[model samples]
Target: MSFASLLPAAVLFALSFRLAGAISAQTFAPPSKGPLVQTANYTSFSNNTLHNKHVVKGKVFDRIIQVWFENTDFATAISTPAFEQLTKQGLLLTNYNAVTHPSQPNYVSAIGGDFFGLQDDAMFHIPSNISTVVDLLEEKHISWATYQENMPENGYYGISYKAANYGNSSAKPYSYYVRKHNPLMVYDAVSQDPARLRNIRTFNDFANDVVNGTLPQWVFVTPNMVNDGHDTTIDYAASFLEYWLVPLLTDKRVNGDRTLILVTFDENETWEIQNNVFALALGGAVAKHLHGTTDDTLYTHYSSLSTVQANWCLGSLGRQDTNATVSNVFSFVAQKTGYKNVHVPANQAPQFNLSDVAPGPLNSDAYIPFAAPNLKARGAGGGPVFLRPGLNKTLTVEKLPPPVDLYSLKKAVPWQMSPRTTSGKNIIPCADSDCK
Candidate 1:
């Protein structure tokens, strides 16, 4: 549906008012102190931890901050008053899309380049051998971190955390922090590392990081389930952004110094339709002339990885990041970096609504073992491709044989035990419940 058709007259009036006088940074107070706050008697791990902060200059933007919301269709989000208002402050990406359904896979693909056939929101532990954008950033000595709101502790491994005395007493405790929404925690390479885990901090850590001028180069921020709209509405998510992000946009510590902030959703709400989610680029990196402009370039979750790779001239994971059909660098970044993006007609674009459609090592029913990346494939970054050790160099994902029917044979896949098996049941402790 057209944005104009979806936008109500009342919302349009509000948008006009918002554009006339944009919300001020002083309109809302700073984020509240959470469980990670440090007091004279109590010290949190995040407070004592020293986060890595190397300022690696990029071709377009020095820093990138990704703030992900929950499921909301493009039209639905754009029709909202706050979203429409916010669009006037930055460039709107009209053709941005999510890779697959549910949410975890999209989050995983955002950093790892490929989801490895993840189809559910179940707790998964990707093997350490698989390299992510984290590896690429670290290879160039570029610091990165993920700030998850309502996460009880730093580098927390619990499946979920519920706030005490939340909501009605008759109902179960409100699960504010969930593992599925956290992308870095799903990968064993990041979660198992003591240093990397410490970097996976809470919202309180975010406030502290900003206060101390210790924010990293790359940041992934996930609000709680309610604030992200997973358990609430888009209106609630917008309210949270108004309360939190609107103030931070003008803050020198968070959004200044050529920082590129992307406000986007994980996926669309309607599964039958294309996974087109509303996304916008804001911050000091956005040129003054580009404000309130719209870029209709087709982009996917993989584009997040590709854009970062192109901006920093980093090596490619050689997965979907090299796939021209799906991965396209942000137009502004591509223009500056001299990266050519493929423009597929909207009709020819891949339908990303289906889940478990692709076969990979992670899918037990139609399973194919892990294969080496296409070393010859060049990406927007125009750098050498990163190859994980122990991968079969002789086999490429394209050249791999037909998937084996492991489920029929009652065989378990390598890496970790299959989630269907009893052994894998204990992989995620206190899953979908209040651990503490």
Candidate 2:
């Protein structure tokens, strides 16, 4: 099909001349221009020099790493309470990346373990063969759902801005909750099953479900873009969390004894190649301020999913989860009332004298700099590494997955438009221009 053919059908679908006039005549201001924030600690997070020397040894130990992000960190400041939360509780992956740019693909990687060469919100449906961690949970009959804003029970639109009729809210208030937050459900093999699809609940319905003790085994929460801190402001997102999560945190059913909450960004906003995003772990399981210990391994979305899958005994999602080498970031050892006996291994405490290590504070905005190794060093599987003994004796340490030759996948189907909001009707037209 010619590119022109793909223009959204809104023009043709308008019911009348007046309706078209009402819709198309409305001119909207472009997204407000603002400085993109770099990582809060750019020097450390973006330091490719440090990333290149990285290797995974299971010895680093495992603990829950929940993350929350502000706008893309051009400033490189990791002073946020969320950053401190991850540092105190578990290992901070300073060199982590979302792999692909923009938003959707990164979320895809986080859930499905592969980017699949998507860069646009085409609403195109592609089969992700690799099972998601959700798949693992489902196989074991574990329940989970994406408590999405504006999404009805059956909403399936890929990505769009029409809040009333699109996948989520049009106010951009909850786009993050719908797009980046629901990766586990959107791209997983479980989504293919009607039973699983039925599990995806809308944002409005989530509170009552949790209150009634109907909380799923795993829960993915996404706030609107306006509130998610992904768009222009975090005030709404913070308010949303403070409003909902505070109660959930104290809930006997949801946060009772085993619940874990992770907050992380979809990707760095700068589109930089370094650690653009940070993760925060909180709940009964998280240790306090895990501060300076770095999990020095090549990581991205797949690695995150791989860790989740491994922890849940869910099999790998083919090549999507490249760095299943690391252990689960969540730990149950410290939970006050949430998951009990979840089997998080003890942290392998190693005292490394940091007096010898450079100590000036590295703002989260600094980028980790590194050029790629010679072509031979590049491949699908990442480079070889030593496993951390008992923590991951079963994993085979070999060359990592080959680098994706984007040129080769140019013809591949781009990411699709998120399905329509399922409030019993498709209330709005797709925001083709804005969404892309």
What are the lDDT scores of the predictions, listed in order? 0.79, 0.40
Give the per-residue lDDT digits (tens) of candidate 1, residues 1-436: 4355656686566545644554322222223533224321112334543455558899999999999999888877897779989988899999999999778889999988898876666567887778889989988999899988778889888777766423343555567788888999988889999978888987777767876778899999998877787766777778888877888888887888599999999998778789999999999999989988899899998998999999999999888999998999999999999989999898899999887567887766678877787789888888888876666788877788898866577664564322442112223343323431
Please identify model 2 stretches exceeding 4 Å from their true place. Answer: 1-71, 74-77, 80-96, 128-130, 161-181, 184-192, 234-236, 288-299, 322-434
Counting clashing residue pairs in each candidate, in order, gives 0, 104
TM-score of candidate 1 on Cα atoms, chains taken together: 0.86
For each of the candidates, the C-alpha root-mean-square deviation to the true structure, in angstroms, is 6.4, 18.2
Which residue pairs of candidate 1 clash?
none
Best by lDDT: 1
